[model samples]
Target: MKKVKQFGETVEGYNIPVLNEREIRASAGILYLLMFWSWILVIFKDSYLLLKYANMIFLAEFIIRIFISPRYSPFLVLGRLIVSNQTPEYVGAAQKKFAWAIGLVLSATIFLLLVVLNSDSFINFFVCHTCMIFLFFESSFGICFGCKFYSMFYKEKAHYCPGEICDIKAKQAIQKTSTLQRTVVIVFFAFVIMTVILFNDGFGAKPTSLWLIVKSAFSK
Candidate 1:
């Protein structure tokens, strides 16, 4: 029973239980895309059907992660399959459990408000976006936003972070960003603002169908 209920794998050379960070990121990416698509449908189509389903699924998955086992979580299993060919990057399971507890709370809140209660409000919007941001950072940058709070709540320091971020180490030469890079990023945003200002009207105009234009030209 203990074996079946274990939270993480006890791999050799690791003092504590650990999980595959690669699979975690892959799972985060999958959830992020799912929630983003449902959000788009909500915004454009005024449909809550997909969003509600997403919330239910999200809630169930997190419940499994926290209560049952990460190994049995459907999305995690899928993520493992997707990244099976790649090398596994092991990270401490304790911080991940804490992080996923936050996820469970957020998902449950969303399910309650949007699904069970059948309501909408700023709270729902805020929480949904918060989840998206968490998932986005985890998947895209290998950063765990929720894991950042582990140290605050617990006495012990987090171990084996995705990028060894828990350790205090100087940045490598290759990892350092130069002043020119910062300047270029700032200039790029400035250029983007100018572009929007100049092209607002043109960009807002509805596009014409190419087939319609071709047909009209041939007819003429």
Candidate 2:
């Protein structure tokens, strides 16, 4: 975290280190891709066990973030961009606010459509490929669709504004893992878990494993 003086107040003690953007993007991008693959396994591969267990992990992580460490929201990254040293030339107070609105709406629309349409393919496409492609391009070439969209919508308003939150020296970025690395690891792990569930001799005995087994076992 970095400290900076703000308008009419001595703001201090609020600073977040510059993490490796490459890694952070990669990590998030991979997780998003994994979500799609997990969905595929659930629908086409009949890998219920894998999906169930993976969801548990997700739930646990969500609990930790939402309940335990509420301040670790990745969206803060955008907020940081507003005040950090790495503030983009085009971003400013108004642009950041605009970006927040647009980004939220875009994301909500995506989620809503996916749910209402039961969009297996579209969800898979986004989780498995879209996010990765976008993040990869951003990390490697500094291309960002979110950034571009914000620019287009707020170009005139933010043309001369430098959206630096404060005159603070913040860290660079946070990097997770690379796309290739995440894909290989996540897919392999999912496959293994599915295989175990499918092959387990008594998988049907459990409440959630092979539904067929539970159905027949109960019939008798």
Candidate 3:
């Protein structure tokens, strides 16, 4: 689909592809959610075939979105439908395209190394972990690390990046955390850490995950 240019937003006298920020993030959230679940299954159940297919799907989606059209990407189409009624948050699309290119590279690598080569290697693990990290940040917190990378190498930062991460520093309470909030967060984590350390079970053994635990409960 051809991007509809915004009435006035432009950088360096070039009309950028303006898009609904909410839909983009919503779509990303959906995709990441799928990837996270599939990866967890692979890690726990050793579902190599399932993981291979998932990687292939991600690779294809990225290729279509980047090379052909976003409308042709099934995940993005579903995402747009999901957020069709959402209020539009217009953002610069050039940086998003750049970010998608980065995603393309990651997905393509996973497809070639893990799915195609069928290697159960450390490098494949690293690639999958890195992909999850990137996706998790974006889906859960609306922080696009790829967009941050784009801003770092490029002169113009993403205008209206998600979560206003690229926004100029301004004096505001929201920008600064209160001492009480900081102390509460730190104390909470410290307490949890101490509780785990003090009453730990299976200190060296791989703990059974909630997924496995639930399955055992039902199967019995």
By lDDT, who's the top model here? 1
Q: lDDT score of model 3?
A: 0.75
Q: What is the C-alpha lDDT of each candidate?
A: 0.96, 0.45, 0.75
Ranking by lDDT: 1, 3, 2
The number of residue pairs in model 1 that clash at the backbone is 0
Worst 10 residues of 3 by lDDT: 1-10
What TM-score do all the candidates reach, one by one? 0.94, 0.34, 0.80
RMSD of 3: 7.2
Better of 2 and 3 by lDDT: 3
Q: After superposition, how far is residue 36 of candidate 2 from its true place, in Å?
A: 5.6
By summed lDDT, the worst window of 10 consecutive residues in model 1 runs over 107-116
State the TM-score for model 1.
0.94
lDDT (10s digit) by residue, model 3, range 1-220: 2353222234454356565666667777877777778878887997877678778888888788777766567886787788898876666676777878888898888888887777778877888778778777766777777878887888976776776777876767767888999999999999999988986875767877999899999999
Runs in model 1 lying further than 4 Å from the true structure: 207-220
The TM-score obtained by model 3 is 0.80
lDDT of 1 by residue, 50-90 (tens): 99999999999999999999999999999999999999999
Q: Which candidate is the best by TM-score?
A: 1
